[model samples]
Structures are given as C-alpha cells and as structure tokens.
Target: MMTDTDITSPVMDGMGPHGTKVGLLRVLGPAHVWALGVGIVLVGEYMGWNFAVGKGGAYAALIACWFAGILYTCVAMIDSEVTSTVAAAGGQYTQAKHIVGPLMAFNVGLYLVFAYTMLEAANAITAGYLFSVVATMTGHTGDLDQRPFIILVIMFLAWLNYRGVLATLTFNLVITAIAFVAILVLFLSTSGILGGGLMEHAALFEGHELPYGWIGVLAAMHFGLWYYLGIEGTTQAAEEVRSPARALPFGTLAGIMTLLIAATLTWYICSGVLPWEYLGDGVNGSVAPLFDTARLSGSNGLVWLLGFGTLFATLASANGCINDASRAWFAMGRDKYLPGWFGAVHPKYRTPYRSIVFLVPIALIFALGAPLDQVITFSILSGLLEYTFMPLNIIMFRKKWPLNSIKRGYEHPFHPLPALTLLTLCGITFFAVFLGYGTQLVAMIGFYIVVSLWFHFWRYRFVNRGTQFTMPWPKPQGY
Candidate 1:
C-alpha cells in the first residue's frame, strides 16, 4: 500500500531539509549514555528479579537468567550497529520506519511507549513501597497507601526531566553509582553466608536448586529478563548523544556487562542465604529481596542503608524511563504520528515537555491502579514484542542499504548471526510467555486490539494522512 516516496518524504512539521527542526540538543556522551542505560533498569538488580526463584527455584532461575543474559547480549550487539548507523531519537521505532514500514513503525513506537511508561510506573510504585518499608522499620507507619507518594515521586522526576538532560543524567550517574555500591555491599556481606562460593552453595542445593524442575525454569524466563530488560533504551537518546556512533555501543555494552555481574552476584548470594520460596512469594513477590539478604549480616544499619538505596534505585529507573519514553513519543509526534502538540519542544529547556506532560498522568494511573505483578507482566510483554521485530529490522535494513555505501561507527561481529540468535531467543521467550501466562497474554491481546483500532480509525485517518516517514540521517547517494 505504501511506496518508497511515501516512506522517504519529509513531512515533519516545522523542519528544515537538514533535519534539525525538533530542537533537541546533543549534550550526552558515552558516560552519560552508560549511566542512563544502567540507571533505567537498576531496580531490577535490587528487586523484582527474585520472583523468578518462585517459578524455578534458585538454580533454575539462575539458569534462566543465563539464557536471558545471552539474549540481551546478542540484541545489544545488533542494536548498537543499527543505532550507530541510524543515529535517531526514537531508537527501534526509527529503525522500523526505515527498514519495515510506517504501520510497523507505529506499532513498535506504541509498544515502546507502553513498555517504558509502564516500567516507570512500576518503579515509582516500588519506590513508594520501599519508602513504606523503611518507615515501618522505623516504627512510624500507621497506614501507608503509597499511591500518593508514588504520584509525588513521578511529579518530582518529571520536573527534573523538564529541567534538562544534563541535570537529569548527572543525577542518574550519582544515584546509579550509589545503587551499584549498595548491591556490591550486599553481595560481599552475603558471601560469607553462602560460604564464599556459588559452586559450594550449589553443591548443597538438593533442597534448594531445582525444586520445580524444568517447568519452573521455563516459567522463570520472564523474571530473569528483568535484569537486563531496559538497557537497550539507551539508544532512545541517540539524537541527544554527542556522537551516537561511538557512544551508543560503548554505553550499552558497559551497562549490559555491569548488569550481568550484578545479576549473577545478586541471584547466587540471595538464593544461598534465603529459601527460593521465601524470596518469590506473596503479592509483591519479595519487594525488598536485597534488603532481606542484607539482614543475614545481622546489621540493622546495613538493612536500612540498603532499603534507602533500593528507593533511590527505583527513582533512578523511573526517571530514566520517563526520559526515554518522552523522547519516543516526541519523535512520533514530530513525524505526525500523533497530535502536533506532542512534537513541540520546550523553548527554554529544549526538552519534549508536551510528551513528558502527557505521560505523567498515564503513569500515575497505572502506578495506582495496577498490581505490581500485572504491571511487570505487561511491561515484559511489550518489551519482548518490540525486541522480536528488531532482528528483522536489521536484516531488512542490510538488504535495502548495503554496508559498503553507508558509514557505520560500529559493526556487529558475524553479521547476521547475532541478529538470528536474538530472534531465536525472542521466539522462545514469546512461546514461554504464551504457555505460562495465558491471562496476561489475553490482556495484552486486548490492549493491542484497542491500540490497533485507534491507529486505524483516528491516528491513520486524522494524524498521518500525508506525512512521509523518513530517516533523520542521510542515505547513500546511489540509493
């Protein structure tokens, strides 16, 4: 239905031929991108991941984590290549637009918006819950609802994002450092409890390791994915990076490697000290698992420190998600995929103020209304759906635009192998989610149907009628 002219036409409102109309400043470097990548999902290192222990026990969960880690590594490699080549704000949405089509790009953009905003909501709620826990520990909690506190946290972070990316990322770097230090402290303190060796603890895991067997391991894949879930979001800031070609790969790789080590230590040490059942039980599914591990050292000071550290970690994740999601929405709006107002950049701050404002209320509603598990399930499904299409994007991009023509700052090793590997892992994970979480899958389907209808009836007909979906960067001359 669409042609090459329709795909490459520049219908961006208020934009010049050189593609600098949106008013986003390039202020981020490799270090800032790395911090944003790590900060966006740092809470996973402290909490939420322990829920996998319930599905597969400690050992099974650990194995599932290993598999998920490999999936992310492959995805990161391919993404870095694409990000360097494209250097766009919307990340995968931009890739989908160029390689696939506008419809597919629309879907990917919506999926990412849902994923990041829902994640932000989840992190905000988790921060509120952690604050309540600390308050309780101090014997000052009567009836902490947490919804109001969550809203307050969201507003605060949104204000920070509205200020500027520099202040936002600098805050991210500081909190991320503190959060990593807290995680290291917990890992070190719990080492003695686990007899100082993961293998030694595994040897004694007859009752601990494979309680639920292969089925449990299969079910835990989703939770295991939580560890490195949002690292790819770093590419969302490509337009704001000083040199995306260099920064995208370095920042994303650094973030993923850091998460890998943290995930290994957190899972092994926490599982060794506490029963897997205890770690992943009840409504919140052990919201403060790392803090619980810290309790093994019998240090009240350490417990309180970790608890506050968990709060800050959640704040950082929520903040980064807001930053990434707003940019995606702004990119879509700039391309006329949504309302024109969403495309507007703040004259003073030069940030996507409209999109940031739009997302806050939605995040607040989700944070207050949805259960923690459901929120996380929805977020994971959205993320997996976005990831599923990425390899295809890479393949199609290469088919259309040969490597010899375009300049690439970084290239993935083995070419298509990494992309193929990512596809296989994504397929397996989707199958697992379908088999394990049927209700959630149905809910996701229902949500998709609603979004599809809105796009068809409203967005397509009203918003994007004559708009041309073009890449922000230049193409090869022959093409």
Candidate 2:
C-alpha cells in the first residue's frame, strides 16, 4: 500500500538489487548544517567580495554589504520556513514544485545546479592559484601550472562526497571554522589588540571618495552577494538532516548570523588596512584581498596563516558546492525533470553518487579555461535568478497552505514584510546587475528562456504532475 507520496517507502529513491531502499542519509545535525552553508560562502569573504570594492570603492562596498546582508537575511528567513515544512532534498526547487508548480521548479533546479557548480569551479581554480602563491612564497616558482591542482581538488572533493554525506560535511565543519578564525586573527592583530600599526582607516578614506555616486553603490550591491552567496545551500540538506524542523531553521538562521558577523568584520578589517585604490583596483580587484591585506600587516606569520585560511576556504566551498548542486540535480531526477538514472542513490553510501559524478565535467568545463570574471558573473546571475522567484514562492506557499493548515518547523514573523523585503532587494539587485553587466544579465535570461522552452515542450511530459506533489500534508486550502 506504499504510495509515491510515502516518504518512508522503499521506492522513494527507487529500488536497488534485492529491493534495497536507497536514499540520502538522514544523519546531519545543526552544526553540519552551519558548516554546509558557511563553508560554501566563507570563501567569498576571503576573495570574491572585494570585487564590490572595485566597483564602488571601500565605502560603496560597505553599503553594498549592508544591502546584500538585508537581501540574504530575507532569504534565510523565508527559505527556513519553507524548507522546514517541505523537508526535501532540493531546497527551493522542492518548495517551488510543491507550492508554485513544476515550470518554476524546473528553472529553479537549473539555477541551483549551475550556480553551485560554477562556484565549485571558481573555488577549485582559486585553490590552484593559492597553491601557486604558496609556491612563490617558498621561493621556487616562476609560475606553477594550476590545472593539476584544480583537477585534483575537484576530483578529491567529488570523491569525498561520493563516499557519504556525514564525512563530507563533518570535514567541511572543521576547515570552515579554522578559516573564520583566521579572519578574526587578522582583525585582532590589525586593530592593535596584538600590537600592530597597519590601520589607515581615516588616512585612506580622507580623499578616496566613491568613484561613482549612488549608482556605484548599486553596482556594489550586485557583487555584494559574494558575502553570502551560498548560505541558502544549507536548505539543500532538508531531506538529509536529522530534524528538518529544528535543524533547518536553526542551522540556516545561525549560518546567516555568522555570515553577518564575518562579512562586517571582513569589510572592517580589510578597509582599515588597505586603501580603496588597491583593494578595488579598477582593472582587477585584488584576487587575494585578505591575503594582500595580511602581507601588508608586517607579520609574516599572519600572511602564512591567511594563506592557509584562503586555501581551506576554497576547498570547503568547492566541497559544499558539490553537495548542494548534486542534491538539486538528484531531486530533479527523482521527479523525472531529469533522467531517472541520476535519481539513484548509492546503495551503501546513501548519497546521490550518480548525480555527484555526473557534474564533475560540468564544473571542470568552467574551471579549466573560462575567464574568471565571466565565470563569477554567470554564477552570481544564476543565484539572482533563483532569488527573484523567492517572493512568488513564499507568497504562493502561504496563500495555498496557511499557517493553520499544517504543522511548520519554523515560522518567520511579519508575513509580507520579509517577503516584501525580499522582493524589493531582488529588484534593486537586478537593476544593479543590469547597470554593470547588462549584457551578461540579458544573456543569462535568454539562456534560461532556451532551457525553459526545452522543459516546456519535452521535459514536461516525463514529469508526473499528480504524483510529484509529495508533501505529506492535508489537501491544500483551495484544492
């Protein structure tokens, strides 16, 4: 009598030999949840976020940080409530499918996969670059080939994920913590708490006004996502967590809280040490901004420490990206938006082994030869596209299934406030992205349109419309 909606059924992830049930391990707790989210995003603080500085100077980047922080705060709150109830592998894709419908879900799925995979590629490439920096520090390199390190990092982390979720995220937790502390170490040393004299806050800001006006702050907001790009990836753990209700809300909110602290501290520390002219160089912002700041600290120990922190942050990011992207892919496959072949979980490891392995080359494609700026823009645009849908997703979710309709793990207060805040921020961010990278923004929209057509005409047939509504709740309010 087991039905497709029966989450505990043996066939939920499809059957294996001897009729063994295979699915993701539901063993993760809140700390692992924090690690999965913070691990992916801490890399932004270490590097990519300074691009905002490049766009708007240090002051403008700070404005962008505050704005982006508000944007993701809305994301964390809204996503926490939805994912807590849905409790599925796909995160927002699952929420969209169960609440809004499959068309939106399909697009969201693609967004998640592409966003995280590209991020994974970026992290791997950065790892290779950091490795080269280490080599130069050791006095042994004209230039070391980065391809081997990039390939090695991807292959190794994908292998780690293929084995099991428990080990994968547990490893993420350790490195992510060390990396965050490294930032704190740098901050304390530079604040003169540890007897340093590198701060030039008033001196640097005296004449270095924002290169552009408020429009420049808008431009910074676009790149500001680097501060908190992948925290929503925490929700991808819904199906895998020990307690979706407790863990999803707690871990996600906690992760955002941590990011707010980390982002503010990172901006404060770096802005104090480095001038607006160098941190956000008009041509190419410092790739290793924190490390650059560290080297300026007059402490070689801090330099090596930040170096190790950078490497660990990238590794953790690539690892978390692999986890989130594969989950979205696997969830889509489970509902037949993708081939069911990807839906299979490893019989022993209880991980989405097939989906994890399949995405290796997709990530490698961008990591190997793509322009770094384009890769990052592509990733950020993908994430922004996903955020644009959140207001709709939350609005529909509440309308269809009111609070009293069923139990919820967590409920964010001020129904339309968070949703409205999310919508406004999404609008501002879209304009900001369009202002600077208008071509890429339009190109990404077109790319989604092309795939969306493919999904509408061909992929829709494979999706079982009736059966895909798997949330184990009473009938929806209107239905």
Q: What is the C-alpha lDDT of each candidate?
A: 0.80, 0.87
The all-Cα superposition gives candidate 2 an RMSD in Å to the true structure of: 2.9
The best candidate by lDDT is 2
Q: What C-alpha lDDT, on a 0 to 100 scale, does residue 296 get in candidate 1?
A: 66
Whole-model alpha-carbon lDDT for candidate 2? 0.87
Count of residue pairs whose backbone atoms collide, per candidate: 0, 0
- What's the residue-level lDDT of 139 in candidate 1? 96
> How well is each residue in 1-479 modelled by candidate 2, as lDDT tens digits?
21123333334322321133555778999999999999999999998888898888889999999989999999999998888777778989988888888889999999999999999999998999888878888897587999999999999999999999999999999999999999999988988888856777888888767788778898899889999999999989887877778888999999999999999999998899887867876235578888888888878999989999999999999999999999999988888899988888898999999999999999999999897778888999999989889989989888888887776778899988988988898889898888889999988899999999999999899877677876666766687
TM-score of 1: 0.91
Clashing pairs in 2: none
TM-score of 2: 0.95
lDDT (C-alpha) at residue 379 in model 2: 95
RMSD of each: 4.2, 2.9
Cα RMSD for predicted model 1: 4.2
Q: Candidate 1, clashing residue pairs?
A: none
